[model samples]
Target: MILQNKERIVIIGFGPVAASLVEGLLPAVTAGTIELIVVSSEKHLAYNRVLLAELAVGATRAEHLGMVDETRLRNAGVVLQLGRTVKRVDRSRRQVLLEDADPLSYDRLVFATGARPTIPALNGLNFDPHSEAQLPHGVLALRTLEDAMNLNKVLQGNGRVLVLGGGVLGIEAALAMAEAGHRPVLIHHGPAPLGRVVDADGGTLLIRSLRAAGVEVISEARATGIQKDETGFTGLVTQTHGIIEGAALVLSTGVRARTELASSCGLAVNRGIKTNEYLAADIEHRIFAIGDCAEVAGQAPVGLLAPGWAQAGWLAQYMLSTPAPGPADPSLHDPISLAPPSLESSDVLMLKGQGLELTAGGDIAAGLWDESGSQVTVFADPAEGKYLKMVSQAGVLTGFLAMGLPRTSAELVLSYERGSMLPADRSTLLRLDDPGILEPAGAPGPDDQLCRCSGATHGQVAHAVEAGCTTVAEVGESCRAGTGCGGCRAVIEAMLKTPVPA
Candidate 1:
């Protein structure tokens, strides 16, 4: 892992995790130890994939989603190859053949190849994706910024949209289309749209919220096929509900890890490229992988951004020196292997769109708690669009979910993550209006985070305020607390109101 002067370190993808790795590797490159080459198959520079739905909804333009500054990247002596897809990887020769350009050589290759959208074998989407597949006239998958731009173009025609799949992206896309004055029908096979994320109560209330925001949700309807008439693609043909007519279709099915190039080069790949604790694939020691595409066997590939970011941080640090103690080459013969990629973790999902404000995570239903013999607490007020459910085992808050209560959701997420003990009177936890009744036993420790989006802790935000950050905007400029999704602005303002410790 020792990087010699001018070491050619070629990263395959330019997604968020790879950008993070490059950001970490930037400081070390001052001595010219590594020659960095980032090859992106995408035509445009790397943008925030998570906020592309917002782009489609016209909340923000495409220019706002940029992850890295091109001028700064150029100043760091980094080479960016846009619109270049790797046609093949020659492992023995240490070179990558490009489709549009000549081959490029690398001393050590890193695969940050991210995931691609999973289109079901439905009548509309099933086809060979590699051989210039043509989807139905107006059907598209909201995978990249380019896709978002195409969706916006469709929106301009004031076309009625038939959004397939009931995942997060599907909901957001439908809501965006609805906001742009198009009536979009949301069809889901499950009884509740987000049954996996929310409980029965939360799901009901979510339906209410969506309806109030002018979104039409059709539950328990499985689409059998996409019908096309003489005009073109008509709409969705469901088994039970019959045809739901619309002008266009957008599919938001989940994604699979993009591991085609890795598999082509004789590397072991299951759902993702197999790796060990250090994230070195079973191939060469210098050859490594990270992000959504890399999987430590026995563990499913983490499709979320946080775990991939953690993996990149570790892999970037691990690749700076000599290899870890073990056989540099883990055998590819064993496909179902296990690597301790990270610590035990949980993800907080925020329903992101123009008007949908909901956050859910962990075991979030009474039925789930009953199976584990854990105590369950519940609070439901559908009229006000609030639902709170908590799961406790041996006096520790194990899992919890709060909807329509931003403050409670943020605090509950912290409590679950820190494994905090619940108060003796558990019922008071849902008292959102009376902050005194629901307050924790003590103030957060200095290391405790006040804003997860910006990685600002109590100490950091407090110090920034103490250094004369008088307003939320000023604080955001100083520490980036309220700048992201604006979900943590309330917490930041409250922190600013208190006597911040040095």
Candidate 2:
């Protein structure tokens, strides 16, 4: 892989992956080795799609959603082409056709066009441009910041808000609407809320949380059609029940990869644009795909910020390492792959290698266990929505489960990962006063997930810290640990404060 004097790189879709790739390639860009061109179908540059619900509720402004400033990209010598959709990609000629502009030839082309919301094809669900049925007036889908802004305008006054799907997005949207003083009703075809990710017990806990937030959750209910009156959407017709009246309907069903452009251009497509481990399409070596649009080796796409960020960095490094470099190492590691998706029921258990141990089932109930597998103590209060179970052997805390509070759980997991002996009194186990509870002197376990958002383990953090990351901010900036929810900040901060063995 040798680059000529004027090698051009064109990246399609200015979402997280593309934005991250551009940012990661800044050093090479400054050196004048590469000319980068970013093409986005959206009028705006890269923005954070993860917080669309927050934007919908007017909690954040549209400008705040953008990931990077245009001036920064311009400073890095990257060309920005916005509001122009790619018409087609001619692989044989290595060119990309834009909607209004001339064809652009590229030495390397990247397809990072993200996924789109899957609006179910129901009867009479057409968008009426002339009437109030159009978005910013009535029904809307929360995907982009523009969509959120449009929805916010229509939801000024109080009205019935029907939320379709009980997934994370749907739940978040429903909660946002309810919090905004609108009556929100959630309808899901699944048996329980967040059924795909959490078990029935966890789902029950989540449902209780939603209901406490004034959200009406109706599980095992499917929407068959949209009921619209002379004014606009009046209600939604269910498969089993009769019509449920509502002022507006929001669809959070799910999304599919936006592969119309790729498929039309004769690129191979399975569920998404099929790519190898290096995120390169099997057909064309010069072309690479990332983000939600690219499926690696038939694995279900993670479709999160962490994986996309990793993909971008690795892809940029692979592309830049040419000429003087030997064969580029195509092997890429995504820390997010280790962390469980929030929707999955995978239990983040803390196990004691010895006799005493505590296990918290998905129900948030903690159960104490002994070496003989005998249940010693069970602490659960479904009514109060609290569960704390602990297991011990030989008068020492072996295992524990503190559900609903992941920060607390993570602290306990870290304690267990370090194999620290618990205090004699079981009540003191929850207290963080003891310094010995921290990961054993300098031995940070590899399996312990340090960055909860990206599922980066303790070993990964230690490795990054050893590689010149002296501060938590540096570690976060370099590896993206405390970037998302900031839940792992305490643990990362504690590690940074603790002195390593001499």
- Residues 1-502 of candidate 2: C-alpha lDDT, one tens digit per residue: 2246757888999987788899887877878988888999888888767667767777777786666768977997998999987888986666889889988888778889888777765666643321222332356678777677766765765677788887666876787677776678998888786664444554666567677777888888867788876767788888866898887788787877777777777778877888777676733356788878887766656667666776787777777774211124233323223222122212343221111122342332333332474334443456755445555555444555554433345455555545565555545544332344643323446766666455577777766776778787678667767655444677788777767656
Q: Per-prediction TM-score, please?
A: 0.85, 0.74
What tens digits encode model 1's per-residue C-alpha lDDT throughout 238-269?
88899988777787777788888888998888
Best by TM-score: 1
Best by lDDT: 1
What TM value does model 1 have?
0.85
Model 2 residue runs over 4 Å out of place are 1-4, 126-137, 229-231, 323-379, 387-408, 411-448, 452-478, 485-502
Model 1 CA lDDT for position 296: 65
Query: All models: lDDT?
Result: 0.73, 0.66
